[model samples]
Target: MTGTPLLKVRDLSVGLETGGGMRPIISDIGFDLAPREILGIIGASGAGKTVLSRALVNWIDPPLKVTSGSVVYKSQNILDLPAQKLRMLRREIAYVGANPAGALDPTLPVGQQIVEKLRAVAPEIAHEEARKRVIDLLGAVRIPSPQMRYHEYPSQFSGGMMQRALIVDALVSNPAFLVADNVTQPLDVTVAAQVLRLMRELTTRFDTAIVFISSSLPLVSDAADQILVLAEGRVVERQATKALVDTPEHPYTRELISQIPKIWTSEAVAIDLPAETRKPIISIRDATRSYRVRKRGTFASYSTVRAVRNVTFDVFPGENFGIVGESGCGKSTLMRLLSRLERPDSGQVLCDGQDITRLSGKGLLKFRRDFQLVLQDPFNSLPPRTAIGAIIEEPLKTHGIARGAELRDRVLSVMREVGLPGTLYDELPLGLSAGQRQRVNVARAMVLEPKVLIMDETLSSLDQTEQFKLLKLFEQLQAQHGLTYVYISHDLAMVRRVCNRVAVMYLGEVVEIADNSRLFFDPGHPYTKALLSAVPTLEERRYKPEECLLEGEPPSPIDLPPGCSFASRCPNAFGRCHKQSPVLTARGNKDLAACFLVENTLSHAAA
Candidate 1:
């Protein structure tokens, strides 16, 4: 709501040139970014939100071309600018992407990379000054011990930290306009909240306009002042954030809102286990895992990172057990232990009361056939060159279970179960959409008829509608196959919808374990409470600074304190919490929490 618009887009249309001829990807998308204002773009995957963002900055790569558009900034049309001038114009317009790992340079130290980017934009700035600015930018992103972390490479940083670093890199030049394209999609809820909060603050402080593109309607609704709904590469509706959420007019917008999984309470749904399958199918008894990481300063010295520390839990047959936590919280490591991909450093992982942690040769192969893993990134997880049929058939062929016509029939059958069309079996994964690729992943895992399925953030990358469809498919598959699921995700709401029981992990240990309703409604651990509070709702887009806000980043797993892993960030942390690590103890009816406060409350109730 200012004098001059920061950026303006008019009659923008993008098209892809293929063997079949030119096909329109985005059509006549027009919008304005006013100074210090955020314009949120909400759309499902393949709706052309990403293409529209690329077109704004004139970075539409290969095979795709912007046929018609005018990006007006600083009283000039950027599309009409010369190559040299266009490059200069790009310095004042920045873009941050969703995948931090792909965006960063692994060879260079993260801080050095930031300095190099800054110098590229402003060559006049000295190296010493650029380094200082990089440190300041890192601090602004809430990265703890910026100076020390500056020397570390991208591999050392967690997913959340890397995303923040990418943000720091994007803002180094203090651009007049910023394009954040689904930047928080891959991040954990708490980290996403932190990054979004930082972005809002930095944009406001610097008086920068931003175009925030996201598939999650609630996320964009909470982060931006105005929301633009896009469907089939066209703008369907545009309105203020609150108005759009409260009374969405467009059918597409309304549908997007309806698909979001809400936090469930006990009364909302029955979360009971089947009577015959009450016995634990998979059990973890004091399981621990550690990795030796080489020290930065000393070549010979190394530190042991306790990735999974005394993690103990049970997965009942035919029940969905959810593991929720931030990045580097040992969720994936624990999955590895359960799947027998990696043996635990200590203790045992029992399958039907038999330890399978050290199973080898024929036994290991049989165990692998009984358990399968679904990874997070569907596009990357699937091979680009291979056809969908081959990818799904590989699992069956590897185990020597099927071949020839039988193999093709099995793949197609599973594909139908996951809602993938049989016609696309011969098509490569590169041509399919994100949702379809994930369906293929599900089909591939289910082809082997596994008894246990471990989904590690499998649906996090998809749009709300796609996620909803996949969640339904998961339930159907579970019922049909009698599969036990260990769902690992940072999405608390999705976990609530899909899981019967939930375990909240912090750093590298389980902080709380309870039924879905109890975990969401009456979280016993402070860390769990903070995580739930950080989730964005339809009514509220941003986390309140005062309500259960974690004060600082988690401590490094390599040099963890002797006490509780979450003690540093726990709101109710006490002297005992900092001195002694609490074990999971009964807090409520069938609920367990590793917290001194919960123990005290239980004792008081008994007294």
Candidate 2:
């Protein structure tokens, strides 16, 4: 705190060229970053966090300009630097964005792309040396088997691995300043915690100052030394992480902190299901789904990817059921089986006591009417060229349910229910906000009058404020229509707030299932404990991260080892765990878990 600042910004303001005139995006922003220090910028969506981050690195594009103030890095004002000098300065200032999949070239090997970037930044470095640095950095970031993964393409890497690879790319040049913009937003809790920890370590190791930008306050508090809260394009609060979290000065900052979900608290209550609807609206019994993929290098040799393995669950009517797991744990695949998008290899998917897998033609159409799926990624889900009204009305037209003026009325009615204005009905989705786009998605799904709605990471893309609003809307819609929700997500806090019952999946298998209160308070499976420990929160952790946090990734689904799928990563795994697979059995009142530790504990208690 006493040394020279690595980067300094004063009275900074960014403006966008609008039809009427120039409009201010971020005004009078000021911050200073010491060497090896992390300054976290926290705000909701449209709060100019991204714009401010881009401006800090002089990456602002046309129509958006830094109207005033200075961004000085190492005594040099970067905002006033010329094109040639600014390009050279940027090499020392790195940036890693939120979207990892779109950051790298798919055609090239993952390591090779970083090597190319290093060479471009410093032509003096040889190709082989650059490649070595990349491989070394990859390992430093905790990516497994860096040497073997060096030749693999981006598509071959999982989401968490690819994100770490991108971090390696940013640090390859040994940048003095790094801007990480929402880097951990898309990752699951375990992977996100890993990334946050890694970034803090990298700053000390590389002697780099980082500007960490995110929409999550608890997440920022976990990684940052100091926190800056933004609201409507202005700095509302700034203080040390503990000081701000404990005694907030600004009302906006207090509001942001209040929105954070409280786990292990009495705030979450178990929902009571109606006894009249005795049967489960949807049930999956031993459902297994697999895919055959050609090996990376082999021409004819292929591997079977057991995406969803013997997954069993029941979703009763009028209750919000949740499916949660890390990426590639087969949550989406299981959702597809429930929605009839894919048939199981050898099991049954029952809808209201009837096997819907064999249904086709009119029967399948009728089944579709009862089940609707809402996908993640609000940007790409809706058609860009189509009008909003037409997009929402497609399901109705496809089913031949309505037409003409009647259809228009129905579409507008659903739009109003989802809080979308009818004036934007004829507008394309190009300029809409992320929340607005998701509302359009909701309206489209609701127009069909489905009895069950399957949301696959639907709220993952939105900021906390938008997510909260949409969740309130969902509660109203469910209450009005008696709809059952199947929410599949990696966000544990959201799951804790909404779901009546939750199913925890691991490596294509259901590892644990319990009521909302039971799952959070007293988990049976070790894997479930690990997930809870990894969740980021301001409250005191119920599970110690150092003890329960897993070290390595799960074994490959294609070549899954015999015995318990979680044996390798589980901290409580034992000899029997490696020799025999555990079956889901009762642990408590309606609680089920597939772990030998639980079985042993229950057996010992009975003895």
Candidate 3:
């Protein structure tokens, strides 16, 4: 559209070679990307977005082949290049994928892995220079203490940190063009916001071009200069970001836009319960959990990670209570504490007036029947070799709840309840869609007839279409069974749509807790405000991202500071914030905030 394009595509198509014949996965796609511009490709899962990304870099493997057309980068058609030329071309073209956990080798240090990649792509570069570049890029991505983090393994990094490290890995070579495929999908809102801002800054600083791919339309609209919508292996719409969102010509584009959850509007769904009249089904009083891990590159030296510290909350019966935070804020550890998977080092976890921390033997089994934990990953959570029916029935058999035909009937009953057809009962989970597998997961939990369910980022991995359906199912199940849910997630939009009450955590502490309407509209703690500002939405933001979004990762849990953990990043932090920690105190009718600013205001008001 402007001066000589950096990359040009015309009539590109990709096909999967099947036994029946070749079937098209991407058909007749075309676009032009200029230097320093960002193009976003958005669609639901299985819309051939990944296939198109792979084809752009010529990374297509066996059973997948380019059926037609050309992808010309700098006047050379990449689709027609040989292996040797392609290998050399990679130095100027980089691709960063969605799943950072599996990208790097767990056995090697993260920085070492990145440096090795750099040396492989550009063998002429010296090892020292490559290492220095990787470290600098890591710092550029705002990973705290890059010099120390460089020696840490992949397992030692949290989800957000690992994702940022992967970006450094991609940019260390100074590639002119990048293909980032759903890089922020696994991150919490704040971390995702940080990553998007970093990408925008990189395009200006490095003069690089990018093709950002994701399922969420709002996320893409935030970062992309232009958007290309794909549906059923074809480009459905391509226009400037604001123009397309404000007035779309295609029906598919409109449908995708409709699926995004509303955050700051009257249409957003919320649960309003009379929580005061009911007792807490599960209550945590001053619960604290910690662990000891070996120091980086040290065999004997160890340090303590205070994963959850002085956390306390209560979930009223039949209420959807939400726990929201970024990665490494101890959401998972607190979930484990609530489910009794790991007992806290101190404090009490009570269930229906009974201390659940001390449950053992049959008592523990009974507790299991009363409470169920649904995990995040849909692929690895269930056994690959086991049949779906047998997987669901294992819990029944283990608890001795039923036998023979009775167990079979109960399993089918729940399978139907969760909208999973009975035909797949005998089939292994080999090729089931992510949503269907998650349905199996829900069926497994529902079959136990638990009164309370702890969902830990349960819907994070699925596309918005699937998440919406599952949320409706959860609501129907709750109404029929009178159930209570404790949702642990980094997805603030989803939490806003479903939860009656929401809690914000930072550096292993409860920074704020309030009703859903209050938390989103009038957050008290700076960290809570930061989380709200970072949520990706099409509506005008209640909290401006530039004013409240945090700048860097949370402080290390291994050696937390004596004062407020959030002080280092707080924009309004004063002298006292760096000297003394604050406790959760009353803010309004039922809201709580842990901030000296709020404490001072309340004191002044009383006087």
**TM-score, one value per model:** 0.96, 0.96, 0.97
* Per-model lDDT: 0.85, 0.89, 0.90
Give lDDT tens digits, candidate 2, residues 1-607.
Answer: 4489999999999999989989999999998899999999999999999999999988899899899999999899988899999888767999988778688889999998899899989999999899899988787665656776798899888766787888888888989899999888877898788878877887878888999999988889999999999998999999999999999999999888788888877456356678844899998999999999777678999889899989888899999999998877899789888988889998999998889999999999999988999988888899999999999999999999999999999999999999999998899999999999999999999999999999999998788889989999999999899999999999999999999899999989999999888899899988989999999899899999999988876787878888998999887778898999999989876889998888889999999
lDDT: the better of candidates 1 and 3: 3
What stretches of model 3 exceed 4 Å from their correct place? 267-275, 297-299
| Candidate 3 minimal-lDDT segment of 10 residues | 266-275
Query: Can you rank all candidates by lDDT, best first?
Result: 3, 2, 1
Across residues 303-421, which tens digit of lDDT does each residue of candidate 1 receive? 89889989888888888999999877889889888888889999999987779977888888888888889988887899889989999999898999999999999999988889988
Clashes of 2: 0
lDDT of 3 at 423: 93
**Which residue pairs come into collision in candidate 3?**
none
lDDT of 1 at 319: 86
For model 3, residues 75-179, the per-residue Cα lDDT tens digits are 899988999998898889999887775888999999999999999999999999998988887877767678889989998897778988998888888789999
Using TM-score as the yardstick, the better of models 1 and 3 is 3
